[model samples]
Target: MKKELTADSAAAAARHARYGTLPERIRFEDMTEEVESAPGGAAASYDPEGSWKSYSCLALDLGL
Candidate 1:
């Protein structure tokens, strides 16, 4: 059989568990919602000066 409790009892149990228990913890405010998006578009997400020459290097090494 399942156990059931009234709202008052449930609240009391919750308060006891939250305050009357052995506990140590830390809490922080959520700052993600206040974050601002990047100033530029997707172009700013990458390094424009970066080069992709790894394939060429690998081909040269393998004599492909």
Candidate 2:
């Protein structure tokens, strides 16, 4: 049986068709383009406790 193609798999196939594949060895210097970073030190001093809030148990509600 043939497997179904997911959205991610389809996108990956399209990308592979367009750009082929990556080289065996990727260098850090090749990816040294300066892109826009997070505002100041927001990423450095991120409060994970405040961000990752607990969610309701969906599995229990669905009786799984």
Candidate 3:
């Protein structure tokens, strides 16, 4: 069967492509310049804890 795609699914796919699996943490220095240049830019502080959560929450809020 062919799977249908929705906005949420597309968002999740894009997220996975960019960051791998959920709850995956990424560092500012690790991100590409284009991504870092986008709105909000990179994390100001380098807190290893909960950074993935923050990114996921923000992504959801922004509707991907």
Candidate 4:
């Protein structure tokens, strides 16, 4: 008898071929409204180069 291939089985085989194991951990985090709005606020008023540095430093300060 010929066996039929399945989407789930194909995906699992591909993962094992690439990584030697299936992925086991997954996590998700929500972005806050304030964080989403800050970039637009900064870009409107500040130079682009300086704004990115300032933003990166702010993120580091917050340990994000």
Q: On residues 23-59, what C-alpha lDDT tens digit does candidate 4 reach at each position?
A: 5655544433344455567557767666565455667
lDDT of 2 by residue, 29-58 (tens): 986888887676667777778764555678
Estimate candidate 1's alpha-carbon lDDT, on a 0 to 1 scale. Answer: 0.73
Q: Give the candidate number with the greatest TM-score.
A: 2
List TM-score per model, in order. 0.28, 0.37, 0.32, 0.30
Off by over 4 Å in 4: 22-64
Query: Which candidate has the highest lDDT of all?
Result: 2
Off by over 4 Å in 1: 21-64
Models sorted by lDDT, best on top: 2, 3, 1, 4
Count clashing pairs, candidate 3.
0
Q: Which pairs clash in the backbone of model 1?
A: none
Clashes of each: 0, 0, 0, 0
- What overall lDDT, based on C-alpha atoms, would model 2 receive against the true structure? 0.83
lDDT of 3 by residue, 1-64 (tens): 9999999999999998998966769998788665346554466656788667656466778888
> What lDDT is reached at residue 5 by model 1?
97
The residue-by-residue lDDT of candidate 1 on 1-64, one tens digit each, is 9889999999999999888976555455542357677789777767646646433576778888
Better of 1 and 3 by TM-score: 3
- In candidate 2, the residue pairs with backbone N, CA or C atoms under 3 Å apart (3 or more residues apart, or in different chains) clash, namely none
